[model samples]
Target: MEAHLRVRAALLLSVLALLSLLARSSSQEIQIVNAERRIDLTSHIVKVFLTLKVENIGASPASEILLAFPPTLIDRLALVKAAATVGKRKKKSYLPLDVNPTELPDAPNGTKYFSISLLNPLSAGESATLEVLYILTHSLEPFPAEISQSESQLVYYRDSAIILSPYHIKQQTTFFKTPSTKLESFTKVEPTNRAGTDLKYGPYENHPPYSFSPIIVHFENNNPFAVVEELVREVEISHWGSLQITEHYILKHAGARHKGVFSRVEYQSKPSFSGVPSFKSLLARLPPRVHSVYYRDEIGNISSSHLRTDPRKSELEIEPRYPLFGGWKASFVIGYGLPLQDFLFESPDGRRYLNFSFGCPLVETVVDKLTIKVVLPEGSKDPSAVVPCSVEQHLETKYSYLDIVGRTVVVLEKINVVPEHNSPFQVYYNFNPIFMLAEPLMLVSVFFLLFIASVAYLHVDPSIRK
Candidate 1:
């Protein structure tokens, strides 16, 4: 009984601490809807929706709210739909305009605010919805908008703003992990503005008499935009010995926005010159101890990339062609052969399973379309993959190479995806052994049948010809 009482005391204290945080945070209520869940490797086409919540504790009604959306996100937005309403929602007249959007505000307040939902009167206890959408066009921000060997450059967030409605908002803390040890009860978090780092933890406010979250990040222009433009991975499994992965990748300087133009002259004459960092090249990482690793591209052999794998460290390095400056592009193709044993995982209890990303690249591109063909061994054809398919508009093609009808061809079409969407697109399919042995057996049977027919026909054909 004494121990039980001690446990109860601890629990009660925890709840009290949480309440304290809620009571003290800026605009203590926040609302957000995440759509990253709707992506897959086997099937494509997707939709992302956002919903917001606001609370009204203030006596006077709230006015305009400003927020920034990254230009990358805007360009990559796929089939977007947006709507805004206040308190059970009485629609308000609103407008959209850029801050430095044109020529007036040279202010560091270079942010965008929602002039929508002016005043439909959000009653004392109500929430609102602020909607917006766009595609994920690209990554790789310019290191320095301009270059000068003499000085360092500063980079700020772009398209980053806040969603304001009233005096306070409540969004549960769910995205990142909390630190193991901390002294403060209320931790600080940087709101997701379309800006650079330097985001803060709380007193981050939200709705009611909505005031924007007061925080920003500034840094000396220095992170290189090391990005891969496109990646295509193909795994061919041969029942006999190998699982071959033939991959093609495109490298680019998604950050080619120069202030004026490239200045090699200015670049050469600097004392420890400081300017925006350009993407001169790229690097590709391969899995452990991959044998016969051949790296090439459509143009030919990519001599610039480096490949290395230490049995101890198990690492591989693949580099790019020329130094990628702002606004340049290139492609690469590489292949690796592995043993089938790599895919087989046996459990302590004797169960079997496979964990793989059915041909999904971490960062995708303007993929107009994609077709994935999975080949099983001889006599193995009936394979069933369940779940993890997203918003697929259609799925009809069913065929393959040299197998009676061909293995199944699954195609997924997705656009406006960024580096963040890469992981979720990788899917895990569950299959049994029957489908594993179909390809090889079918090949041998056809070869032998042809040989038998050839022998029987020789005598009759020769006599008829004479």
Candidate 2:
């Protein structure tokens, strides 16, 4: 046993050495010719766009490019997308590429990397321009933590002034666009410039690999930070032509906490200025051709909602009993019905499936915990689910109206959900169409028994005849 352990340790050491060698060799082969980064800080969500010009400097061809992020941002990063440009000027077109997380044994400073696979191998001395869009959530800090209803919200954002890269950058610039011109303070690195609501970092030249310069910006932003602590969506399908959807929400204001008493009179009278950071209403987008929509809570049905329907989609505008301030929370439910033909389809092999949205419908809102349950018809068997991203899934039994053995529920749970997670997922199962007659047959049998009893009672002789 001791000899076996020694052999395993030696093998691990050799593998680590090989990985380190590969990491060093790749960094020397590629270089960033130019880079332009734009960051939008208008709302609670942070969006960054990077346009990179890359060239292969070594003799070998390069098949992928590495993207680096600091340890602080690794968990908060929501989505990253990359696309390569073709043609020039007005004729330019973009081809989407795959982006996946990669690990290196010799990373410096706990750095993380995402590799973007190119369409074709980049030959030596050949250059390509790639555009990447990444999103981050909960990256802003609420300064002073608590404030009165009349006070505007202030936040602090920290990031590196220089772009984090494993390859040397010849020239690069970073630009930031804020919601307003209410700047408090910002770090200046000699050439940093602030004009209106825009801030420019640098057009600096000649930066070595793994360069980083930290900076911070403090500014005033009054946008609402609406966050859903948890959202549970349940979908029930009926072969009789209707699809039912119900969503339960626990929404909270994730901004600075509200201090002192909330004065409703001041908020109502001074709508333009008072309670600038608080939100009174929210909008949800639903699929087109929705019907029987309702918004309610434990108290009763909520009457303060308006729904507009068009050929493309339906919009629901709702208001809670009170405005949501910092640290405040509200609970409610939204239910709707959709035509089965729109979302339910039968495959070539005689299996039925449901294609539905995966996350919350509110605009510009973040959900920390999300649970989706797809309740298939009562007689379904051999269930399966397909989702683009990773999710925890399990099977459950749910009893509904007229169900004998209970319906099969496909439960999917995910955390740290953003708007990018609102994609379609499918649940497939085998179901026989003959089982649709079960409910009708049961009702018919009950009526027939009642009819026979009524006829026998009429024909019975009473005591008067005796």
TM-score of each: 0.50, 0.95
Q: Score residue 296 of candidate 1 by CA lDDT.
A: 74
Counting only residues 3 or more apart in sequence or on different chains, how many pairs clash (N, Cα, C under 3 Å) in candidate 2?
0
TM accuracy, model 1: 0.50
Candidate 2, position 202, lDDT: 96
TM-score of 2: 0.95
Which portions of model 1 miss their true places by more than 4 Å? 1-156, 159-210, 213-222, 226-229, 258-276, 310-314, 344-353, 358-401, 412-466
* lDDT score, candidate 1, position 327: 53
lDDT of 1 by residue, 18-105 (tens): 6655433323332232111111111112223334444455454444223333323444443333355434435554333222211112
Cα distance off (Å), candidate 1, residue 133: 19
* Per-model RMSD to reference: 17.5, 2.3
The lDDT per prediction is 0.42, 0.93
Clashing pairs in 2: none
